[model samples]
Target: MQLVTSVNSHSIAVMLLTVLALFLFTREKIPLETSSLFIIVALTVGFTIFPYEYENKELHSIDFFSGFGHEALIAVCALMIAGQGLVRTGALEPVGRVLSKLWASSPKLSLLLTLIVGATLSAFVNNVPIVILLLPILTAVSIKTKTSASKVLMPMGFATLIGGMSTTIGTSTNLLVVSVAVDMGMRDFGMFDFIFPVLIAGSFAIVYLWLVVPYFIKERRAPLMDTSPRVFTAKLMITEESASKDQALNELILKTDGMMKVLRIHRNSNDMYVLPNSKTIIKAEDMLVVEDTPENLKSYEKILDAVLYSSLGAVDEEHPLLEEEQQIAEVIISQGSKLNNTTLSQSRFLQRHNLIALALHRSGKKTETVLKDIAEISLKIGDVLLIQGKNEHILELKQSRELLVLDATSDLTHTKQAPIAFFIMFGIVAVAALGILPIAISATLGVFLMFLTSCINWKDASNALNTQVILIVVASLALGGALLKTGAASYIAHLFVLSMDGMSTTFMLSGLMLLMAIMTNVVSNNAAAVIGTPIAIGIAQQLNLDPEPFVLAVLFGANMSYATPMAYKTNLLVMTAGGYTFGDFLKVGIPLTFIMWITFSWLLPLLYNI
Candidate 1:
């Protein structure tokens, strides 16, 4: 293969466009999806304006579009669907429950356990799936422990990255480096060949992320001050199978472990009311009203397997409250509305609009009254209603003049095939770990199983595809290809090595890793690894030194993509979820990347005896 010089007109234009794309991404003045599309257009036009020859083949516009269909991007999109399957079926909820118990006792212990789980699982499985699996569990832990999600989410992401550096199968970046080395006539790194060195570096990083990074990341999520978040009212029916079947009212309260309070009890036989005392024994057909969030309510409802009742009569299991498209929104009954002064049951609100009132907030109203009956809740001029409905009805509220929808959140429902979904997820990791199939093939298979098992429908699966992440990754790959094909990266690599010819061999190795580290943060890591491998071999041959240490340097430095969110996909995932800024990555990532470089520079020479 042949390469073109950067002095060519097309190469200079590509470099200029690369710098502008970086500005658009780092400044974040526009959405990533839009910026990425602009980059694609720039490359397409630039290549068209000035064609160049490389390896005796002329560069064409089709070459630019090829990035969109890269294998790495396809694998990531498939992993996201597998993640959605785990979340949809609530397959990991049991794991979350155990973590919740630990978090209730100690936040530090819970974080340690979470980090351990993340690092160990990421060693064998890909890092992306590890983060996806732990995301919801940590969220539940955060809610239960009353900790801000910002504190733990980054540590979780970093843990997986460090672990990925330990094994070839850990991440595609590591595997690509090994494959490139093998193609260059070097032996492939065995499974544990690099684990010891990586664990040495990872140990220090884990401590910094666990103990130090949290203090730097302040809680950014504002506490929910609006009453809507806390307005969900749950109606739990007492059954003969209930543990508190015949227990006294006070004993039932004592048995609940502060889960909920029994506002009132109703007789199931006829139209009647029962005011119970400490000695009052609960009956099998008793109704209990409690205030709880939808998540907590689901737990309690599942524990009892009892029925839920409303003033509209006994609510069936098919209600929107438990549907995948179920949503809760805060709506204000507007002025001059027919809903004013009329109860929900009287207005036939569910019948008219296919919506149900979960709770109502009337400020300055008396607090001691048992007003859990959403059906009897009367609407007022300024009263806020927490409404629950399917997507159709939730969107329908926007068209109604009588109410104003302030905010809304949709709930996801899982299928009964949770066990199958969980099995498929486990099988994907197991097959890949055993080297029976490539990760891309195993993951692609897992996605097919998700659809076959009914874990996710076709529409829902399509919605999981984030075109923004896909396009940005594609555009970056194209830019890296442009750099390599133009001989830009190779030129820089050789020029630096030539400039440092007078330095000691150790110093040259250090300078090489440092360059790879910087380049990895700018371009994709796979590109950096591919570009750096030949440079490492060339430098080692010039110095009459072993090529192994320099090759290892390229591998380690390429994985140190910590300086920017765009440098790594896992970082981007956490960035969006944590609501982080570019400054956030610079805050901790720069120091860590520096540490990794210094650590490798210091340790590699001692281990390889350069």
Candidate 2:
């Protein structure tokens, strides 16, 4: 390949910084926020220290931070909040329930239907919540059928990625690519402009996921032994008239067959005791804060004849003064969640949400049995908290994006405002699709309606905005802008064209998609889309061909973030829920990636007659 000697030093430096940012993004040791901040700082300081003048216009340092308020970022955030409102109001839960019924009726038929439904819903709403909605249903199906969850989860996640490639508003990466392309003088793509190709390619992809991918993945058991493996810490109140009022703690242990661990004993408001010996005598009105899984906790309550409660107020629903419907559910802490790295006590979890956390489950890490210790430990992504509360309070928790409610048994029927939420979402898509309003404006207006209609509140809206996504999009924009300004994208494109000088247009398109597919798995898909969109355009310009096919290639390839858990947030979510390894993603994602890549590479050229 011949080198482009005419490329300026600033372009070379920007390219190097981009490479460094990619490195930082892929390193699990470095936090995403830190890497994004580093990249933004480097871009601003580098441009400020040595400003670059192109065509007598100097690129200002302030331009680097402009990405924070970029139109694409606004649209992405607004759409996210809107999607949250749909979930908050239970607008989409009915779909999940219907799908659940289908699964129960015919597991084999439902598997195909699952991929189709998942992909269809994902094309319209945010795919992450779509995965969140289906996750528990699939888990329940897996357990009921005595099948492994590992078989279905990865395929379902990949199916969403397929759907996300269909429309401009389908995925954040798609939005960024289209937004960048518009800024670079290409006609803006409509919401359904690219759907035909994606649907065509995605059909084959979905078939592979439904039929072949399950066999590729090994069957791994979900962490459910005699009930959910998630442990909760509940305080067992020894009532004055209970059967075991004066029983020895050792005797209770003997009765339970040594199955439970008594983490601590609370004698009174003024005194708390550590783990008691086998001979420790249990007294009336003493609070025994025990640590065990939910099933085992209830069993212990039955064995000791004590009432289990999270707060100090009431024992159960039968308490005459406190008559309300109660419920138990499992909620997982999401990545970029406000609850991440904070304790339940520190976050005032109970005081804020009015729900009591009975237990916490961290993947592969046994939580310390002491209630105080468990409360003090910082929560991480994928930590499942077994929580208990009134049905109302538990339903309210679903409004917030921080905690992913995994138990589908909760009554998530549409609220009075659910119809309004669905209408607003439909209106946003309609106006954008009809070209009556740009997506940014349509989505923004939809959010305002969500708040006005009481479908979503201030806290739910705020939590819906993901910090990592905001920062990464901003950083990707900054780098993309710099590349365009310095002609680095053009330089890279010229080199690529020269390297494949003798290759057919079909080979060139395949190569571009393949390159993007690899880069997306190793780095942020948003980054790949933002950066590759411009290069794809440049590659088209170099080849003296229309850029439409090339641009679509970039968009399709960037959304193929299926090869690793770290490639996308949805993948990370399923990793814990399904108990999958890194190899599992590679095993299924690699083939699926090639399937879509080859499909699109051949199909795009034919559609455009390139």
Candidate 3:
């Protein structure tokens, strides 16, 4: 009786910690990595401070930090590097172009194509990089078609998540399951083990997305009137002391702000020079004609201390400047962008890029407040930036990866190493697929080749990695190990089985899957998998059933974090991009979650013979 009571006490303590971890994860009040680290420390200290005997041994003192070197964890990092190589080489551009052309005519068609392509690529590659690469291209297409970006972007992200579940290499979750199974002396899964079930699930998902998701989602339309207006106009003055005094007016405009137009520069005695080249110099009392909004005019006034002039009275008969010389373009924020959570003023976007934000569009709502003095407006994905700048400067800014240009101009002069990049990418994929090399080895090799071929320099390659993501993965793995070593996982599994006794295997599977889905909503999916895998294995051992189905159920369930915006990284990615409310996910996700649960519960036992 004493032993039973002691066991129960230990189990309760561990379960409480697990619950605490889940609560922290779901709230997103703390970073996932930080939450995981705390869980690990708590478990370690609990075990040491209040030791408990289990199975004739004191509860194992967990070396929670060793999961940093886990092979599955290392492979994920390597895959990220490989994906970076592919992006740097411009190898995916042709694929993106072909996809764009196929879906050019309709929003529905575009969504379907994006789903298909995203699913196919995610099966073999990392989903994170795939989504990152496709996001810009999809945004570009939305601009071209004038379609509400909200309609297709979320579906694209979901497609990648689904696709990642289709193959062993599709996501780290699949690989983690296989690794754990191998460690438990179970038959190792081949590369295509998940192909059949995934095909069925994926097919149903695609059809559902095409037929059902559209009906459920509300269409967020752009304004009928072009709320994106070019309102900023300013005048630039060239003085003897000005940095651009001796520079050509055109060159000076380029160097200063592309959005600022020099209507005319007058030397002494009203000698007006229009669009002067490098030879043009400023004499004393030289007046330069420039056009921008009042706020931008003020910025120019502050930056160059130039005198503000009223808007030029129609440089041409039609407007203030030639149509070819000046125009408006829309720019969208992207993932890993330095601009996320920053304001326009703080970003120095106007001062540095020479573009003025005339208006802002978010979640189908338009704001024309000029955004000059507002410092608290946080930039998010899918926020449209209506910028006014010269045609040449707009093109230059468009070329940058930080912002996706929404204008309808194609500039193909930028050189890209398409063929070499393709070959390198292919080599990496082939090596990993054939099992000739592990993904990490092949991916590292690919990164080196990228440098060798000059496909991407070191700076670009480094930018592709998300350090926070890597740290979260490592920390979660360590925490998961601590839970297992401290006997916390076994304790939870025993209690779950006890409470769920007399239930059918289907009921048990459903319950476990639902529990995992809930846990993932609060914590990292990888952490959920690591902690859940062992408990699932324990449950299977007690039930005298095959562990594969339960393990796969846990893996699949961990990824099905659709009910909350904080559930998965991809969920958060689309939240701001889609202008989604927290309630929005619950509206769409609850049904999807049920569908997946039912599909997997029925399918797992059949496939694995549990």
TM-score of each: 0.60, 0.83, 0.78
Q: Ten residues in a row with the worst lDDT in model 1? A: 222-231
TM-score of 3: 0.78
Ranking by TM-score: 2, 3, 1
User: lDDT values of the candidates?
Assistant: 0.67, 0.82, 0.66
Runs off by more than 4 Å, candidate 3? 1-14, 40-62, 105-110, 143-146, 180-187, 222-227, 235-335, 340-350, 358-369, 372-388, 402-415, 573-575
Compare the candidates by lDDT and give the number of the best one: 2
RMSD vs true structure, all candidates: 15.3, 6.5, 7.3
Per-residue lDDT tens digits of candidate 2, residues 1-610? 1223359999999999989999998997687888999999999998899989986889998888999888899999999999888877878888888888988889878989989998998898889878887887887677667788888888888888888888889999999999999988999988999999888889999889988878767988645312432445578888988898888988888888877677688887468775777788889888887756566777888988888876445445553222236555666777546778788889898778877566676655563332434667788776767666666787777655456775435234557787899899999999999999999999999999999999999888887888889999999999998888888988999899889989999899989989989999999999999989888988988888899899888888899998988788888788777778788888888988888988898898899898
Pairs that collide, model 2? 232-358, 232-359, 233-358
Tens-digit lDDT string for candidate 1 (512-542):
8898888778765765675567657756765
Show model 1 residue runs off by greater than 4 Å.
1-7, 123-153, 167-194, 213-221, 224-416, 499-501, 504-590, 604-610
lDDT by residue (tens digit), candidate 3, 1-610? 0112124566667667767776776653365557766776776677778886755777554655555666776767666666665654556667777766666667577678789999898887777656655665665566567666666766777778788887777887777766655655677666777677777777776777667876778765432114344564544555556665555545655555564555556666566564644456655556676555555655665566455554554232344432346666666665455666688778888778877666676653446445343335788655666677777788777555445555544332223765776787778778877889876677778778878888777667566655556665665665555445556666566778889989888889889999888777666777688778887877787677887788888878887767776666666556544556667677777777777778888888787665
